[model samples]
Target: MQAFDNNLTSVIKSLKSSYGLAFFNNLTLQLHQLINADYTFIAKIDKERYISQTISLVAKGKIGDNFEYSLNDTPCADVSDDSVCIYPERICQLYPNDQLLIDMKIEGYLGTPLHDSNGEVIGLIVALYESTIINSEKIVALFELFSGRISAEIEREDKEKKLTELNLSLEDKVNERTTELSSALDRLRFTQDKLIEQEKMASLGNLVAGVAHEINTPLGVAVLCGSNIEDALEKLNSKVKSNSLKKSELEHLISILNQSEKSLSFNLTRAANLVDNFKEMAVGINTDDLMSINVHLWLNSLIGSLRPMLHKKSITIELLVDKNPPNFITCPAKMSQVITNIISNSAAHAFEANDDISDHQVIISAKVCSDILSIKISDNGKGMTDEVKDNIFEPFYTTKRGEGGTGLGLSIVHNLIINNLSGKLEVESTVGQGTSFNLEFPSLI
Candidate 1:
């Protein structure tokens, strides 16, 4: 009894230090020594295939290796059905045709079902001898004790293998998802760059159209005046040929010539001024030249250029400047674009044809407060809802989609003010009352 207890303790200790096949081999060797048997082994049974694998075996004081054989006509087949099988002095009488028993010359046998964690039979622990065995009950009890530990070890190994496989699968999935996200981000950035370039081209086109419209009227007036002066000269030549020119007639001709000269000069000057303003705006758009200029004067000039577009819609713009405005050293061209986009947006969205109101007014007010420049542009037109106001500056979001509105006007303005000028933009609006845009930036004087 003391020997059995010492062997059991050693087996349990070996289970802690060793694992899988090594643990099973050590356990089987110990049990073989304890029982003084000719053979001791542990077999893993496959009930579905009717086969069993010898995981660990010891024979006649020598270590035996692992193997597999059919479970047909074997004592292990009976032990797998949740039962203990012990044949004392069988000597091949019970199963005469059992080839394994006949070859090994087993006279005694003891085996018990090895259950898994869920109490299902998976294998068996068996001890066999060439001679009839005494103390069979003791051997069976000892085998049952160690069998539970063996079952637990097998379960632990299976779980570890499954966990390792799961970790590998999760790692692969994470890497695949990361690669997909990187590709998506690259495509998105490319699309954004293209959209920004398109918006800039659209703004340039609007500027060109406005300048042409404004210059057309003055040029037409100048041409008409020139034609009238030519006719008056022809009449004076005819009078000189006849040599009958009166003083009153000569005075009338002079008066007519003076009026025509004044009209031609005024119109020509107006056309020249329009050309100069357009050239400045074009230069500003194409280059990033910084200059120190009066804020009041610059803003009023930009508004004047945009007036041709606004006037067609009968939209009236009013500019209010501070008493003493500061000069700002900044990129005027970028600022011009920002202001143009904002005012253009209002002109397109803020007004309806109403005979009751004489003016669809846009008021632009500029002030310098505490070294900061504040410009407020407000329109008394149909205002925006809360949702529209919230997403107004988002790229590709527009209230006028499919109506030749690209939705990039305010988005470009926002990017220019915030990124180019290091400034802030905010908006206030009521659904029916009006909308106001407040812009502020540090005046680098």
Candidate 2:
């Protein structure tokens, strides 16, 4: 009995931690060994409403050769109801010797109830022998002790299950919060970028308007003078029709008219060119979409677009494109933005106090070999200090802050070059002489 109690205690503790068919099967084997008996079975009340549930014999040792019984008529049912055990008498009544035992040659039996929580029996354990094994009150006491341990183990297992469910619920909540925070941050960044772009557009608009006013004044005066010359020509025609025109008078009129025409023509062409350049630089437009653009062509176009901005400060613009520029497919809008911003940076920062426009000169060039397109834009204006170059591409890091600069131009340019186009931008600068920007793009067609 001492050995039986100790092993039963251990097996109950193990059952508390496990579940399903495997737990019951092993429990039945342990119960058989504890009782020093052969043949053990574990059966459950598989349904709630049915009084008689099918028997599932989990482990069977060598005691009974074969046994059969009705689920509705078994000795184990009595113990299952009251958490007790039934012995040889009840077993004989359930399986009579003449009917069940004599055919099998002999019989003995013992069984204990297996309960779930709430003192409700879910199953029972049975042990069998081939001959008389006397039942005693000591045996009943042993069964009571084992039954209490099994109940405690089942309760502990249910608590552990609830704890596992709570942990999963808490983890899901944490993941949801992280996702929300990430989305909020992304939206905030997008709004910030929009504000910067708007600021740049405003600055460029003011510059364009000022330059247009200056050019229009000269153009308007030339047009007025041309009208006066036309009136003089009409007078000469009337005089000739009246047969009163002298050669000298005629020659003077013609000379005046010719001079006026040439002046007007030159001024108008200059004004138109200036207007075109301003429009190209000021407008937000992109061609080529995502086509494979020729690198040399793109370089020329980019310089032409920025020519007016450079001209405003008397910067001499020069292009030195390689003979063979490889074609590359990319977002033209993004590429144009990068070039415009870099060139504009020079216009904004490459000058110092009382810096003369005549001293400013900008040079742009490109070369291509195999699958690489390299471009360089340099200026001979007052260059940057080491400190400025270090943070040049940082958003809002400008020396010309109060001059209506948003400082996002270089940052946006940097982003477009690297993030959008998978390119790199490098810079070299000096305090007094000049600055240069080198950009490289892969020619991925």
Candidate 3:
């Protein structure tokens, strides 16, 4: 009962807080553990074809490939918008034609139908157990508790899919504007806001994911605290109703509420502080405001954010500068975008063909001579051709068209370096050796 209550509290909180593809994925994973089932899935029904397509599936405690199955002879076919079905044992024996059950050796089955806002049966959630299910009533209660949330999210996702398709046309229009940037200096400033928005969203996904993970702890605590307060209040109410309420029990409830209040406040404040960090990232790069920046500190901070993305690819980033690095006055955000673009570009394109793990390295070294702050970002991976290097900074001149690459990263970096930061950008490459990008900007901007 205690475990189920905690799990129920967590499921409700997670369902409320999550969005996007992650929403379904997390729910399926959680349900797999929560129900202690061998296979758990959330599926979208195709009533026309009598099929169910698993959007999120977990099998044997691991993420499994999504597939479609006919509901013609399966137990899932029996579930209606208002009907839930559970077979505690010998499900395969009952449904002799259900090949999936026989193949997977599934004995127990619990399926709850999902309904949209209009109360139409759109999908279902299924939990399959290899062993006999001992708690059918509990499973039914759990499914009943979350079926609405699941249905709403599925409906929301469908709407979002439509909106995303519509938004693609707007994105195309925005991409068209990017073509005019290199031709017009005035136009560059005008369209830069949109460009920065697109670019920041691309490079910052990993950062957002990391922060989301960090924020989850505090958010979970706050949710747990709120649950505790509700339970305490329930106990107090029950005692009052029975005329068994004592002064000590009332005082204990007060103490519980006080502790919960403190925990909720502290954890929520912590989550808010983590969110505040992202607000700094939301600052527009089009601003010409120059701020004093310690070169090494700024670079380290930028690299720290990129580390997660790099580490995923088994790549290493080395900051080859001393502790007493020079301080400069440059637009920090623009500088960040510049560095971010370069690192992002290198991360995506540089190490593609290199089979050697040890060779997957990006070296960033900076030094100040006179009033010029010169920085070099070099990648020890597959180098580019002279022709490719020449046109890399050109607008919309991408080598990765079919692979979702805009070819705008280097162009943005180029424009920011020359027009925004009063800097010179240069690139050098040898086919087999490596590629190097040198950025020289004014130190006292």
Candidate 4:
């Protein structure tokens, strides 16, 4: 037992290196030389089988090729099957008949049970010969030393195999998760693109409404003035033919003609103003003016730009700005885009059930408080549901379908507020009441 303990200690030290297989082979050769054995076998056992385990070896002389044995036949089978180290004496009891050994062409056998790191007997190290050795105890002790060394090597080999399997499994799981995440991102981008298109359509719809209002006013006035002038000319022609045209009537006629001319000129000017405002809002060239701009000033300007569209829909727009608007360094073109998206959204979705346009209203207000620029846009439209509100800032969420409502309007507004202006946007809404969007920007921006 003391000899076995000493051998095990040495083997444990050698097991530190990654040469478990090489160590086993070397120990097997050493045992053959030390015991002067003709045949040596290193058998690893798993469950109730020997598994035909062996390493490199030396055959002392000509021996039969077959050395295989069933778990019930071998002298050391019991020791190999145990969960702890087993001495050679206990192994002898399992193969009590010495005749059985002789039948296998072996005079004597020496086996040291091989153990794993956890000290479980996984196999055995053995030496066999055609004749019995003279010094059996000395030979048994040397065989035990070799067994201990082989046991350490086997333990290391098992751990390496397990570690390899674990690494392969981890890599497989990481790849699967990455694929799933990539697919999800692609879907999100597709949805975002769709929403952006919707936002543009909404803005276009509002522009169309403004254009109609613009054209209608001038067109209506032109028709009225043309009709009145023609009627006045006919009355004068009739008076001259009947000799009823007097000096007082002539003077009055000139005054009436002047009024008609002024009316045409005034209405034409209004029509031109409407066209210019539309052009500026829709297709104006970008400007590089970096100035300290008043938040209230831009809000008012945007509301003015959107006024014609809302007015035509009878959607009353009201503005409440602070007496002194906070100034921020900004690009007006980008700011205009943000305001346009928000106001257009309200004009498109505010009115419920095709009610009179006049009944619907949009409010634009701005104030600077606590070094923050705050702008609020509230509408008396059919308000959004909680679910709709939650996803309103998401790229493609929209309630408008066929009317060319690109869900991107609010999304763009949100991005501009946050990304460009370094700000935040929030919304509050109640179904059947209205929706209010609050935008906050750092005064510095």
Clashes of each: 0, 0, 0, 5
Model 4 TM-score relative to the real fold: 0.59
Q: What range of 10 consecutive residues in model 4 has the weakest lDDT sum?
A: 83-92
lDDT of 2 at 223: 80
Q: Candidate 3, which ten residues in sequence have the lowest lDDT sum? A: 277-286
Q: 1-445, model 3: which lDDT tens digit per residue?
A: 8987898788778877798568888888887888899999989999988899999999988889999999888899988434689899999999999998999999999999999988899999899999999998888788777788888888998999889988998898888787666568777666766665687677667556656666788999999999999999999999999999999999999999999999999999988866664444434544667777777766765676677677666788999876776677777778888888888877788777446646689999998777678899998877899899889988778888988787788888888888878899889888777889999998645
Task: Kindly indicate the candidate among 1 and 3 with the higher lDDT.
Answer: 1
Q: Write down the TM-score of every candidate.
A: 0.75, 0.52, 0.43, 0.59
Candidate 2 residue 441 Cα shift, in angstroms, is 6.1
- All models: lDDT? 0.84, 0.66, 0.83, 0.68
Candidate with more favorable, higher lDDT: 1 or 2:
1
Predicted candidate 2 versus true structure: per-residue lDDT over 1-445, tens digit per residue: 5866687679777777666445645565566666655456655554454343323343344322223454444455565575455455445555563344345443666667767767687655566666556753554556566656545555565678788898888889888998999899899788766867685564455455545665776699688867878798888989989999999998988888888888888888777766765554444443434656666666565565466677777777788886566566666556666777777777777864467645778888877766777889998888888888898888878776787677788887787788878899899998777989999987545
Error in Å for residue 61 of model 1: 7.8
lDDT of 4: 0.68
Q: What TM-score does candidate 1 reach?
A: 0.75
Top model number, lDDT: 1
User: Could you tell me the TM-score of candidate 2?
Assistant: 0.52
Off by over 4 Å in 3: 1-197, 204-207, 210-283
Off by over 4 Å in 1: 13-29, 32-111, 126-138, 223-269, 284-288, 294-297, 322-326, 354-358, 368-371, 385-388, 394-397, 400-408
